[model samples]
Each structure stands twice: as structure tokens, then as C-alpha cells.
Target chain A: MDLHLGRITWFQGGRDKVAREEVKSLEVYETGPTLTFSMGPQHPGTGHFRMVITVVGDIVVRCDPDPGFVHRGEEKMCEYKTWITNIPHLERPAILDAAGMTYPYVLAVERLMGVEPPERAKYLRVIMAELQRICSHLYWLGLMGVFAGHATMYMWCFGDREYLVDLTQLIGGQRITHSYFVPGGVRNDAPSKVPRELVKNFRTYYRMMLGKDYPSGEVPEDFRKYVLAVCDFFDTRLDEYYPMLLDSPIFIYRTKGIGVLKREDAISLGVVGPVLRGSGVKSDTRIDEPYDAYPYIKFNVPTMDGCDSYSRMMVGYYEMKESVRIIKQAVEQMPEGPVKLKQHPVTIKVPAGEVFASAEAARGQCSFYIRSDGTDKPYRVKICSPSFRNLIAMPYLIKDVRIADIPIIYWSLNYWPVECDR
Target chain B: MSLSKAEEILKRLIEDLRSRFGDRVLEVNVEPKKIVKILVALECIKDVAQYLKSEWAIDYIKGVTGVDLSKLPNNAQEALEIIYHVGSLSSEALKGITISLSTKVSISNPVMPSLTGIWKGAEMHEREVYEMLGVSFEGHPDLRRLLLPEFWSDGPPLRKNYMVPGREGQSG
Candidate 1:
């Protein structure tokens, strides 16, 4: 009769024993023709994650989300590597939002080393972070569409995301896992010049977004204008998704009132980012704890009162636009200076101290608690990933829902296995 | 940037903690301005956690981390430090204040009371701590290996004593 009764054993050798024990505990297990099977990693709906749910007459009664399929022991690995080398491995956890993943770690290490990065480096960090947020949200949007059976929405999102991914490659020198951030500052500075032909194609749009009237011949080398043009384009392009997916009848029917997380429950469970915002809370680590240029940058924390799958979808959707706004503001306000510290990042040994820094990643707040022992390496690096925190809410939300409605509920929580397991 | 507003809350938080906890609160260290670390006794961890949740509106725990000071190049005492990174979401006054409610326990019998009752979100985090650090949370409902495989019988991997496989000869 209790929710927190016992551990759900991974159905291995003694399948019948697991089923029988489950039968004794749950009414669904006791009922006629009950099904006890894992919606495992191989499934399209569940991305390298599993939820062993027990069902009776199409209603899921018990859900035990089994993650850790991609467990690489990321934190353990951090101890062995130098602070500079840890970036590559740490960023791998959440590759989609690599800058966001490693930002807090870099911040902690920077504090430990007692070397503040330049003002330009800080602004560049903000720009890269927002770009990564846009890319991650696009990837998520594509997945949400496919899960809801809107194939066109998936195609459109994936295709459009490539543009941002290219922009990432241009800056970070990598597409997915950009190990661009270091303890001192960034590994490299964002490009100073933009391609002539690229901007020439969208010259009018660039002019309007940048608010300059020059009879274009040479296609201004202003990378800020190029970035702002892309941001403005995305800000306008986001409106198209409303008609394509949000306003659709099937999308509304599936998500409008489904997977409704209450405001109280959201706070108590410690869910972050869009899921928290979707439930009517404006608690963003970017706003709460201003890191890098977040304090200087002006943007709104979007909150939705719907508190359902649709609201979560809307929250993430609006966040993409807000991210664009942050990028534009950061790009325009960025000053000229050296991006990295004068001291070599590789040679620096941190003093003995403990510090924790958290940043608002694409999904939620990704935090790092670093305890350095006056050495090149860390004593303990505790990574509190948002996916891991959000994973606890799976069983709480997945209960008492139809088996068909499982994917929508699970995806709405934004649980990525690698990030959660790492 | 409202950080000053958050600082006022932190000062009040420290004052309230001292008034309530007294000598049980061993130390209170604020890293720069945002993070507050409070060291307390192992026996009163659950009570202190409950008090923080109810009184300070610090309902959610960001994480539960266990650090083995036994392996550190420190002085006499051998102990495992359990740090609970708690923060607020319900009350705006307490927002952005990252409170580390930490306690030290003997390494041989690394056990502490679970805060899952106080913060239900701590269930998985406590489980991870149990598996990784071998620190038993006495009242944890389901204390099984979370991220680790079932075959992992070797002592908790995160401890400094247990050398990570290939990292033995490396400069860690």
C-alpha cells in the first residue's frame, strides 16, 4: 500500500520470483493478465533509459525507472585527470549542451586557482552557453515531435538545428562535445570575422536585426551582426512551430492535461529548468545565481501555469527564444580583451579548498562541487547533474497513467540517461 | 543583481542556525558569498535537516556527497565527511543560498541517518552515496547500488584509498 516500499529488482534469472513478489505488492500485479516488462533502452520512446512498469488493464501502477546504461564513471574519472584535462571527459556527460555542462566545473576550478577570466571571456561564455541551449532545445523539440507522431515537426527541427550546430563548430571547433571551456577561461576565442558570402545571402535580414543602414558591398566582417542575425531569424522562426506542432489537435489532445506536476510537488522533488518553470516556478540558476555575464545580460525567465506536458513543451519552446535574446545581448555588449588568463591553465595547481558552482544547463541546473588538495588534480569532484535529480520524479509522475501515455510523461520530465548516470 | 538580497537571507540563516544548533554546529564557513558550509554532529543530522527544511524553507537537496578524509594528507583524525548541498525553491528570501549541511562520521562505521523523509528527492542521491562511498544511510528505504553494477563488491569506488583501475600510476 506504500509507494516507497522496496527496491524493484532488475528482472534477471528469477523472473517468476520477481513477478510473484511484485504480484503480492501491487494490485496491477495481482489483477488478471498483468504485464511486467521493461520499456528498455532499445525502445525509440525511451532514449538509452529503461522504465520497468507494471500494468493492469492499460493503467500503469508501478514504475521503476532503470537508468545507467551509459554509466562511464565520469566523476571517478575526474579524480585521475588534471583540472585542464577533465574538461574533455566532463563535457561528454551532456554533449548536447557541452558548455553548460562544463561551465560550473570551470567556474569552481577558476575560483580555486584564484585567477579571474577577462570580461570578454565571460561574455563569450554566455554566448556559447545560450547557443548550446538553443541546439539542445532543438534536439529535444525534434524528439518530442517524433514521440507525439508528428514526423514533419521532427524533420523541420532537426534540419533547422544543423544551422546552429554549424555555428557551434565554427566557434568551439567541435559539434557536440566542445571541450572549449577551461579553468582559466575558454580554450579558444570565438571567431573575430564572419564569411562574406554567408552574410551576403541574408544581408537584408542582417541589416534589420543589427539596425544599420549601409549600402552593402563588402558584407561587414562583424561576427556580432552575424550572430544577432541568426538569433533574430530563430526568434521569428520559432513562431512557425506554434502552427506546426503546438496548435495541432493531436498534440493538444495528448499533452494539454497529461503529466500535470503541481507547483508544490515540483519544488519538493527539486526538479530544475523547464520542468520546474513549466510548473509555475521561475527558479533558474542563471537568474538565481548569476554566473559569468548572466548578471549583466537582460532576459526573462519564462514560466507556464499549465503544469502539464504541453506547458513543459511551451516552457522549453519559449526558453529557446529567451536563449536567443541572451545571445544577442551578450554578443552586442561583449568588450575586446584577452579571453584566457595570463597563467598557463595546464601548469596551475589549486590551493586546498572546497567550492561548488551551479549553472542552468539546457535541461536544468548542472552543478559541480570541487575539493582540491593543493595539487594538479582534485580530491573529489561531485557532479550534481539535473537529469539525475529529475530522474527521481519519474516513478512519481508515471504512476496511474495509461500505458500509451507513458512516453509523453517520461519525455516531459527530460531524463537523459548519460547525464543522469554520469 | 538581488545577490545582496540573497546575502541578507544567508546572514539570517547563519544566525538562526547558531541559535538553534548551538555547539552541535561545529563550524559555519561561507565560500565567498553564495555557498554556506555548516559542519554538525552525525547524530543530529536528520534533526538539523528537518529544521532547515521547515524553518528556512530549504526544502530541496541539490545533492548528498561523501568525502573520505581518511586518505587525505591531514593530521590524526580519520573520518568521512558527508555533505548535503541544500537550497531553497519555495521561499524567495532563501533562494540562491547553497547551504552545505555537512557532518563527520568515523570511517570504520560510516553511517548516518537518511534525510529522505525530510526531502523525498534525496532518495536516489542517498542511494548513490551509499554505493559510491560505502556510507550507510540507516533509514534509507532502498539502499541498493544505484549507478554501480551488481558485480561491484569491491569497496566504494569514490574513496581515495580505492585506486581507480587504470589510474594507479597516473598523476592524480
Candidate 2:
């Protein structure tokens, strides 16, 4: 019943398993119905996850996501720096989700210290969060397409994502980690033309043939025709990608019912965001726990009942639709105002208390807890990133998925290892 | 549905906690916009968390952080304190209550109970605490060096006393 396994699996100069003596003593639990395989940290499907997923023959029997690979000790560093300096430190996780990351921290600090941002500042925060949401969803779409082997979708989405990145750069002077949203408000007001430019860009890209016109019209008519013929092809592609893998007859045979997270188990594990919603729970920190402008905005939380890799993809796609709704509402109801509040002393001394702030990040619900002692610096700052929480569900989810399907399952979950480890 | 009702529910729940476990609920500090800091005796952390989650339906825990009150040493007994911010997405009442559990552990043994059992979200927070502040959790399932490679020898990166080798004496 007991077996010994050894580290250092290779022989110095040959293609032989040198740790044979170690393997002989291994306590091989009745190999169950399959062989267990570890998937990440270095695997491409995980992107930055650096997670180690164990599978029992194509089915993920367990997923142990070892994050902290990218932990830069951001919170610890925050205690030593001024409040203003900490914004950039916290925004590093998913640089694509900058608004989601920084907004909560700003809100929490603002609340604790007794400062309400100007109305203009509130509107600007709403606008920036919506823009960041679009940018993040686009990035996920690109990754989703790449995982499905639809190289075209991946390329097109990234190419479109550049526009938003440029918009971010124009506003905050940084393409990715725009530490633009400060405690009182944002760093500065956006250029007046930015909103009009946004409408123009969205109108052009979300329509027919206009997107095809980009990049010197190099795209062939056949591609354009292919895109237009399907009418709702852009929308349908989400569902289509999964079944392609599932019913390839060849591919589906490899990836059906893999990494299944039963509905009840998902909730009990406290798994959040898409992983929870993918398992049919309608839990959204944005809707359930509305913060900032979210209470005034309107959007629906999307959930799927399938509770598998397929369901995970569906959740992201449906959520993308909802994000579009949020952005539209934000833009329509956006009242003219200042983006950030009047500048105060750069070095802010927080009250001697603790504040916990959460926001609906692309990964899930990302949170930051700060404990201050009425000083310019915090006594301790802790970050509870969503990727960290969702990663725990991996071991439970990947029980019986195929080795090839590992990438599919991982991407569908939108696992960002840097955020998780951090 | 109103914000005041949420505040009332939290106060009532904390009152019940004070009755069941006296003295442990040190101070129920509420700051309207910012945070609701519930100061508690370290030993009654689980009892308080159980009340918050089960009785008040405070299901989501926003974040877990530690504050070293080395500056307020004259007024406080403990050198370091752990804080929990529990949020509820389901319950309209008790939307935000950051319950603070400050147990005075010796600077040598700055240990606290892990809340990952109730929230499942505190796993990484606890690991980070272990790595950065060198504060050990009594019941953490898997506590290992996170972020920095296991071999890096810069002791507890976040402690107020921790000094970066190259950056020493560069205080702002």
C-alpha cells in the first residue's frame, strides 16, 4: 500500500528513468479509472498560471494551482510607501484589468479616510471601468480563440484590442498599468474627444465590413463574406468553439465532460465569478454586492447549468455580452464631470483601522484588505486576488479531462497565474 | 433594504456575539463610507466569524490583512493584529463588516488561526502573510514560500522592521 517516489527523474546522460528504485516504492493508489497527469506552471494553456493540475487519464482528478510564482510582495511593499505610490504596485497583477484592480483600493482608501470623490470623479471612474472591462473581455476573447486553435480570431481580437490599449494610454499615459484612478478620483480628466472617439470606434468595429476595412484592406472578400454570411457568427462563435472540440468526433471524443465542477460542490468550495457561475450559480460581486457606480448601472449576471469546460466558455461569452450592456449604459448616462478630485497632500495618512475592498475583476472578485495605524503608510496590506480563490476549484474541476483538453479547460477558466500567485 | 437596516442587523448580531463570548468583542468600530472595524479578542475569532456568516449571512470575505501597531504601542497591548473584512452579496443587511481579530502573539510567535476553513478565499492571503510578514497560521493546510523563490533569504519582506539590503536608509 505504501510506495516511495523520488525527485530527479532523469539519468544524467541517457533517456532512461534513473529513479527506478524510487518508483518501485511508490504507493500507487489503484490508479483509479485513469492515469494522473500534472499540467502547468510551464504549460502554454495556463499562460501565466504556473499551476500544477493533476489528471487521472484525460480527466482532471485534482488541480493544485501553486501561485506566488509572480508574488512581488505588493501588499507588504504598500505598508512602506505613500498611498499614491501603492497604486502602481497593486495594478501589476492583470495589467489588462487595471481599473478593476485599482478602483477597489481607491474606493476603500477613500472610504476609510472620509473623502467622497466629486460627482465628476465618480462619472470618470465609471467610464474608465467600462473601458477597462471592454479591453479585458477582448483580451480574453483573443486567448479563448487561441485555445480553440482559431488563429484568425486570436489575431483579430488582439488587433482590435490595440485600439482600447491606445485609448488607455491616451488617458493615463500607460498602455497597461494605468495607475490613473487615485483615491479622491482619477489622476486626470480624459481628453474631451476620447468619448466621441470611443463611440466612433465601437460603431465601426461592431458593424459589418467596417472591421474588414482595417489594415489596408488586405483581408480577402471571402473572409469578409464568411464573417457576414453567418449574420450572428460573431456571437455564435462562442458556443461553436466548444462543440467543435467536443464533437470533433475525433476532438470531442477527447474532451467531453472533462474537469467537471458539480454545482453544489462549486458553491461549497466558495469558488467565485465564472467558475461559480459556470457551475450554475448566479453569484456576481458586482450585482450581489454593488459598489461605486454599479448600483446605478444596469446589467445581468450570466450563469450556465452545464458545469464543465463547455459551461466555463459559455459564462465568459455571456458575460462579454453583459459587459457590452454595461458599457452602453455607462456611456449613455455618463454625466459631464471631473475625472479626479482636487489634489490633496500626496502623502495620505489613513485612519488607524482596517478596510477591505472588492471589485468584479475579469478573473472574478478581486479584493484588497488594508490595516492602517493612522500613518502615511499602512501597517499591513493584504490582497485576496480572485484567481487565487478560483484556482482552488481547479483540482476539483480537472478530475477526468484529457491531456489535450487541459489547455482548453484552463483557458476557458481565464486563469492568470500572476494574479493568482500575487 | 436600506443602509441603516444593514447597520442595525450588524449591531444586533455583534451584540449577540458580545453576550455569548464576552470581552472578546473588544470594540465595534463603524466608519460609514470606509469600513466597519469590529475589534475582537483573538480567541473568539471563529465564534465571531461563525456569527457573521451564519447569523448575518456575511458570506463573502473581502480581504484579510495584518496591521502592526508598533507605533501605537503605548495604547495597545499587541504588536501585530489580523483583520478580516467580511462582505455579503446575498444579504442586503450586513453588506460590509470588517471584523478585526487582534490577538497579542509574542513577536517571536506571531501566529493566528486561518479563516480559509470558512471563506476558502483566505488561502493565498494566509500564504502571503507567512511569506512576507513571517506570521504563521495555526491551521493552514499548505503553507509554503510564495512569490520569492524558496531559497531567497531576505527575511519576511513586509515587516516594518524588515530592511531591504540595498534600499536601507532611503526613507521618504
Candidate 3:
């Protein structure tokens, strides 16, 4: 048996290394460098994800990602449920990117049945998707910060994330699994004051952090002092974190040259969204393959040629900022229209054909390939998740990096185990 | 970039494949249908896939879906048919294709050739098939349970024989 990293690859020859080598020699071209080791099914910093790693000395020789540990078999289960019922079903893959994942599934169904959502609904989906993007990046930043041992950043990122989660709950009446996105449109429109609340929350969050002289007259002195202290702590931590991560010799040494996936390699591997962009390939499903309201939005697809863990991490940071920009654009361009298409309940019958729809999910491009036999329910639904493709590239990336940097590399990838394992 | 050129190219390629491998080419009707269905025999899966990749640059293996045909089986020995939906990233015009292949193995003890050797993307999909359908891949390196845990004794839950009801917290 050949074990790569901590994940099992191929149990080839019997327990004899010599026999394995002899057999391996016959398949000369396919013979990858012999590196043997275990990474994890459970380990801190790998997030909820753990992969057994194998390295030939300092280089990753092979990586086999052990999935199914968190497998819920979401696709098969969706088959048993009605079209409307599966709204919650699709959201479970990446809890942070619920709306982004759900939107494509909804769009595929709607597109198949030729159902058009109202103008307000389109604007609403964009708002929710962008909000979800921000929230997803916050989770990634928090996880990345925690893995980097920056507890302060983790707390701040997650704390700031709560503000957005609160906004989501206000819109959908739920936080994480906001089954708000349904076929044809959103399940419910945001309340008239909901936008006001959203703007207020953004102001409160921004004033607490980004403002120079944060409206001190608007609040009491003691409360002002407390906010200042919390802000100071996070501001100081952010100041130290960037230089420590990007400029420090030790940190740079670990991240600078680790997990290098080139541009062509990324594209050919079907590595989508930011992972491909991080490798200097300006390929975003939103920009290159525009869908939803993204075609109207203007944002740069950030790219870096470094292709290492640090580059990937930097890519995420910049992309998060871009997502914010998108949200702001979407909000500013909001127009007056009904938020949902008028339709009879249980009357949607999708055409008897498979529709492959993809969206720019936070991690990468998550593509949903749905097969419907002209029915309300899908004949078969196959989700080609971003993490699955990104996970496959681990062997190539983690080849020679030290076991100590394994968690760091994995964290920098921003991989979700549930997403990958699904 | 003209329509006829693409069609002519496909026509010439089909003729070559038909001549090279006789009746093994079950069907090669590649008209611009909604779903690009390429029906081929079990034995010619690897060959036809290579042809698709080399000639058409159908590189991206989009999704692998397994259909349980045990109830519709004319023979008990007939294996479940698996569909490999291949997508080409480079070809903007021709985005995705559905290639259906069938093999008759056994219901009691099912086994099929592993396509992981040809399409590296099918590794997870094959593991899924093995776990859900009980169709063992002959030369698959790691043929363990995928979605289900190692302890779960429920025999290949997706099989027609198995009664997979609406269980609580079963991911729905």
C-alpha cells in the first residue's frame, strides 16, 4: 500500500517495498517520487480538513486527500426532496457561502423551466450573494488567522463577521443556513427598513474600526472608551500581523516558496476562482464566465504569480476587498422592482435536459451540473465542488514542505473539509 | 470557426474512429443537441475517451453520475450504467458532453474497470460508485467507502433493492 501524506493513495503490491518498487518500475512514466508519510483525518490548523501527506525529504512527493469523513451525501438526499425543499439541501456544502451555492442551483432550475425572476429579485440575489461572499471571506480570514496563531485577528474577523450574519438573519430569519434563495427568486423580500438596518450596521462596523474620529458625540464616554480599546487591540494586531506574515524572514521562509501551482497548471487542473487567479491566471467565473448580475458589476480579478501559500493568502485578502466593492456597487445600483416572480406553487417543471451552471463561490468556482428529466425533481444532480479540484492539487503543492508547515499551507489554501468531503 | 468546419471535423474524426475500432463504436452522433450524448460500448470507453481528449480537447471531466438499472435489467448479470459528463474548458462553443457507457457484471458481486486511469477526475466519482452502488473497480488503488462510514452495514444504499426512506438527518 502506498500512503501519500496521511491519505491513502494506492495499495499496490504486497507489504514488500522491493516488490512495490519492481512493479512501480514497470509503470515508469506514472511513477511519482517515493515519499511516504501521514498528514491527518483529525488535526488542528488543517481547519476541519485533514489530509495524510507524503514528502520526499523536504518536498511533497504525493498527497492523497481522504474525503467522506464529513460526507453527508447531499446530492442523493436532494433527489428525495421536492424542488423547493432542496433549497436548504444545497446550502450545507459550504455554510459560509450558502447563497452563492444556492443561487446557481436555483438559476439552473429556473433556466430549465424558463422562469424569469423580477428585477427586484435579481438585485436581492446579488445583495445576498455579495453579503455571503463577505461573510465567507471573514470565516476564511478568521480560520487563516487562527492557523497563523493570531488569536486576536481570529476574534476580530469573526466578531466583524457576526455583524454581517446579523444582517443575513434580518433578511432571511436565519443566520448560517439562510435558505433565502429559492427557485425563481428569493423566498421573501427584505423589509423596507431592512436596507436601513443594513446601512446602519455597516456604518456602526466601519465607524468602530476604519474611521479616524469615530462619532464619539453619538455615544456615551465610557462606551466610547470601550469601543476604542477593542478597536485599538484589533488595529494593533492587524498592524503586527501583516508585517509578521509578509515581511518577517521566518514567516516568508515558510510561506514564500511553499505550495507553488503555476498558471497553466492551475487552469488545466480546473482550479477555479481565486486559486487560478492566485497563480497569475485572471480567470474568474464571474468576469470570464459572467452569470447573475455580475456582468453589470465592475471589479478587477486579482492575480499573483507567486503561487505559494503566501500568494494564495494574499489573493484571498485582496479578493475579500473586491467582494466588498461588488456589494457596494450592487447596493448603489439597486432599483425599484418586485423582488419575486409571480408563480403557482408546485407548477415548475424543468425541461428534460441537464444544465451545467457555475458561480464564483468564495473558495473557488463551484459548478452545479443538474440533470432533470422534465420534472419538478432532478433526475440526478452532480456538484463539482471547488474544494474537490483544489484538494486534488495538494499532492503537487505539499511535496517538499516540512510537516510543521502542513497546517499553514492547508490554511492558506482556505479549504473547507465538509465542502471537499461532500 | 465556421459551423460547417466544426461539423466536418467531427464527421472526419467519427469516420476514422469507426474504421479503427469496428462495432465497438456503439454510436457517435455528435450533433449540437442540448446534451452531447456519445453512446459507446463498455470495452471502448478508454479508447473513445482518449479520442475525445486528443482530437476534441475534451479535457474537463465535469461530473460522473451512476444510474441504478437493476430493476430494468433484462439479465441479472447486467452491470449498472455510468455516465461520464465530459466538459472542455478550451472549447467555448462545445462546453460539455455526455458519454454513456455500460458493462454487464453482477448484481450480487459487481465489478467494473476503473476509469481513474484515463480520467484522473473520476477517482472520487469511482469511490462514490463503489460505496453507493457496490460496483467494485477492478484495478482501483483505494476502493474503500466514500460517503458512508466504514462501520455502516447498510448494503450500497443507492441500489434499487435497498429501501432508502426519508431518514432524519440523512443530509436532506
Candidate 4:
């Protein structure tokens, strides 16, 4: 048997026309060069996002992250809703860090309304925001671990996150999408008395989870013990978590040098949160633009110079510890007063002005630019979410990376599709 | 940093901008410390933005918002106002400062120079603005529909005149 490869020539007009000869050449190849495919919009790796990637063999040559699957016309819809009602809607975008996400909008609206929350309210806001930050970071860590094929890490992070979530529920009535932030202050104060047994159990379980101990007699009585226990639990977990991931050869090999974003490129790409800090940029809105009780509380901004996936994961780990420290400090320094202002949520009118308020959220700098035209509702509200800013880095980091490394690189940026789409 | 320090730096930056642009700078409002809103001509936005980035190191764009000014009394010309929230990460002193460079384009013909060339971060933002407000960024590399679908035939949804489906008969 004879097999013909490459081009096949067919004669046109057959045997009838002997004098006229026509050739139709059809070209075929045994091997193709590159394949272009869509990875998301429904894929487990990408949540509510579609990325079209051109891959040559196993290496991704180009990647285009198509977001907006969850776009609910949030900015446009804010104009139709009252300022206070917008909080619940806004928090839905970044559900994991509900307090942190809504804090900036409240701050901006408060600035426009020329109303300042009381000292106690500000401190409460800080505590709630920090707790939400820890919860958000844990969610990211669990998702990251699961994406990287470490099922145990996911279980541990998600299990540990419940303590923080429970604390948030104690402060705010809801678990996620807590519309706790109001224009002037938070919705409610911490319950007059949190069950001491619950706090003690959280402390004990968290300590055992990480195999560490806290100094006795250092923690004060009352609510301080609960806050201190949270701090101690996270502090111990950071040590254990960091060593487990960083020391593991497999983890190191998969993440250490992969998805490297240079410090300059990180800034240019508008990378934020752990992704930015991982690239050695010490820019945190909490420190740079101090709001609420951030100025009063003292906590280190964890940064790593590695500019890689490993460093980004490390930043997330250290940040959880820092968030616990911030919560503890805020709790210790909290003043005694009313948590909410006299202003009603439904009828609050803001003067005609524009205010850009930013809060250092778990993901990054979540900012709200509100323009009030002397109305109860906002004229225009622009939310520059951290996930939206980090979307720019997707194509840049994924270039020339292996298909297997896609999940690690994507999750390392901590890109939340819902938030970005909003 | 204290408000006074931020104000002083902002004052210095405004003075620099005034000297550089002269009459081209329409208005400068620095009432809110750490936020300087500069209203400039459409043509000079690129020059002003390039100066801010190269000289003061305002590297990243926090956001680009397009405000429909048809209903507002301040915008008598019935123009669409584009605001660029420019920020910095390189300089510690300027990190807190958010210089919002705003420019107005006539409602009939809304077109302005794109800042994507100066700051690559503004690429998606410009696209969003382009799709939402129907304002064209002249030199934008990819000024296509960002959030909205290609099949979307209605005018810019964020514009004041663009009525929602259920609220078509209602008056503003």
C-alpha cells in the first residue's frame, strides 16, 4: 500500500477536455502548530470568568481574561438605590470581606455627608474589618490550596476560617454579605457579652490546630481575652502554615519561581494586596491612608521581595497574622460609646461633593468614588475593586507558563471573578 | 502623615501643574487634602498626565470614571466628564495623594486622548468608559465593549438619557 502525504492535486473537467488541464491543490498537515481554547466561564479553575488561551504544546503563549460574567450593573444600580441600601448590594460583590469592602463606600458617603462616626464606632469598624480580612484571606488560601492539588491545606484553612466567621456573625447578624457598615458607623456594637466558653474553645481548638501556646497572664479579662485568643491562634497558625508550605519541596517547586511579577511590573499592572506586597511594594492603604482605627492600632505590613507565587502565598499567610494583631489592638484600645450615629439610613442626604475613600481590603485597596448631588441617593458611585485592578496582571503572568502552572498563577493573584466583574 | 504635610505637598504639586499648564488648567480644587481635582482641556490631558507620571511618579490609575453631566447645573454645556483617579506607588510622600484629572467633552462629540500610552493600567478602564458612556478614547489600542456584550444595541447605559427597560415612560 502507498500512502501520499502533503498536497493532493485533482484534475478538473475530467477526460472530456483532453487539451485543458486544471489542477486543484489541497494542503493538509500531519501536525498542528498551536491550539487556541477557552478555559473558563464555567471551569472549576476559573469562577464566572472565561480566559481564551493560545497554547503551543503545554506552554501558554497568550492569555486573555474575559471577565464580567457576574456584572450586575452595580455602579449603575447604585444610582437608583439609597446610600444606605447600597451597602448590602455593594458588599455582595466581595462577599468574603463584606465589612472591608463596604467600609470605603461608607467612609466616602460619610465624608460627603460631613458626618464622622464616634471613636467607639471607628474602633468597632476596625475590629470587624480586620476579622473580615482574616476570613477573606483564609477563603483565598483554601481556594489556592485546592487549586494547587493540596486537599489537606484547603480543609485546614476553611476549617480555621469558621472561627473568624463566627466572630463576625457575633458582631454582625449575618455570616457573609454582612450589611453591617452604615454611612456614619457600623450597624450594631459587639454584643454586650460574648460567651466566654465559645472564646475559650476557639482559643483551645486554634492552639491545638497549630500546636502552639500563648503566654499566660498577658491577656486581660472580658472581651480582650477573646480578641487575644484570636490573635494567638493566628500567630501560631502563621508559623506552622508558613513552614509547611515553604519547606515542602513540592510546594516550593510548584510556586517559588513561577508566575514571577517584577516590582515595577506589579505597580504598572495595578496589582494589589498580597500580589503587590509579594513583589516588594510596601504600599498598604491601611498605613498610607489611615482611616477608622487603623491610625491608632499598630501592625506590621508584611511584604516579600520574591515577586513570585510563593512570596504571594507567604504574604497572605503573614497578613492573616497581621489582621489578628490589628483586631487585638483595636479591641484593646476600643472606646466605650455608641456604635451607630443618630442619622437614619433611609433618609440620609449627602451634600453636593465628590469624595474618594479607600480601605485596605483583604484582597487589596478597595476604593469608592462617590459623587452626591445633594440627594438621598448617590449620583454616581465608582468602585475600584482590588480584583478588577489585579485582572490586568492575568495575561502578563500567564505568558509562557505551563498548563499545569495556570491554576497556581491564577489563584496566587487572588483574583475574585465576582468582585472583578462588579 | 498629617493633613498639613499632605496639603503642603499637594500645594507644591498644584503650583508645579499651574506653572506647567498655565491657562490650560481650567480649575484646581484641593479642598480635600490628598485629593487634587484638576479640570483641564481635552487636548492637554495627555501632556498633563505625562508630566504627572514622569515628574511626580503618579504611576498607576486607580480608576477611570465617566460621569454624564447633562442633568447637572455645573455642566451647562451638556458634556460628559471623564475623571481619572491617578495614584503613585513609587514615592512614599505621594502615595497617599490621588490626583484626579478630569476633562469634559461635548455630549454631541465625546472624544479625548487615551492615557493608556502613559499608564498601561488604564487600558481596561478606558474600555469600560468607552462602552459605558459612549466616550471615545482617540488613541486607545483596544477600545471595545468591556463589560457589555457585543449584541448590546442600546446607547451607553450609564449615560443620563439612556433609559432602563421598565422605566422608559418615567421622567427624571
Worst 10 residues of 2 chain A by lDDT: A7-16
Estimated TM-score for each candidate: 0.91, 0.80, 0.77, 0.91
lDDT of 3 by residue, A1-422 (tens): 24321232222222123234533432243425755545556566665554655566676655666566788877777666767778787889888889877877887777666777777677778768877877787777677666666566677778777766766776677887888877777788775443445444545765766655435433222322332333333344345546644565555666777778876666555565667777886666676456667777898878888987878877876776676667666666767777777643754566666566667788887777676665666656767777876776666677666777777777777778888766
**Which stretches in model 4 have alpha-carbon errors above 4 Å?**
A1-32, A196-222, B73-76, B168-172
The CA lDDT at B137 in model 3 is 76
lDDT of 1 at B96: 78
By the TM-score metric, which is better: model 2 or model 4?
A: 4
Fnat by candidate, in order: 0.44, 0.32, 0.16, 0.37
**lDDT tens string, model 4, B3-93?**
7887888889989999989989999977573247999988899999999999999997899889888876464458888999988999888
A92-206 per-residue lDDT for model 1 (tens digits): 8889989889999988887776778889889988888989999988888888888888888888787668667767877888888988888777778888786666566456544
lDDT of 1 by residue, B1-172 (tens): 4766767778888888889888998998886743579999887888898898888788877998888786565653578899999898878777777899999988776777888899888989988887687777777776655676544445678877777776687754
TM-score of 1: 0.91
Compose the digit string of candidate 2's lDDT tens values, residues A54-78. 5554555655555655666666567
Recovered share of real interface contacts in candidate 3? 0.16
Superposed on all Cα atoms, the candidates' RMSDs to the truth, in angstroms, are 5.2, 8.0, 7.7, 9.2
Rank order by DockQ, top first? 1, 2, 4, 3
Clashing pairs in 4: A41-A49
Worst 10 residues of 1 chain A by lDDT: A4-13
Query: DockQ scores for all the models shown?
Result: 0.42, 0.30, 0.18, 0.29
Runs in model 1 lying further than 4 Å from the true structure: A1-33, A196-221, A343-345, B1-5
Model 2 lDDT tens row, B18-110: 787788778776655456677777677877777767876667655556655555534654456677656665665544344444444445557
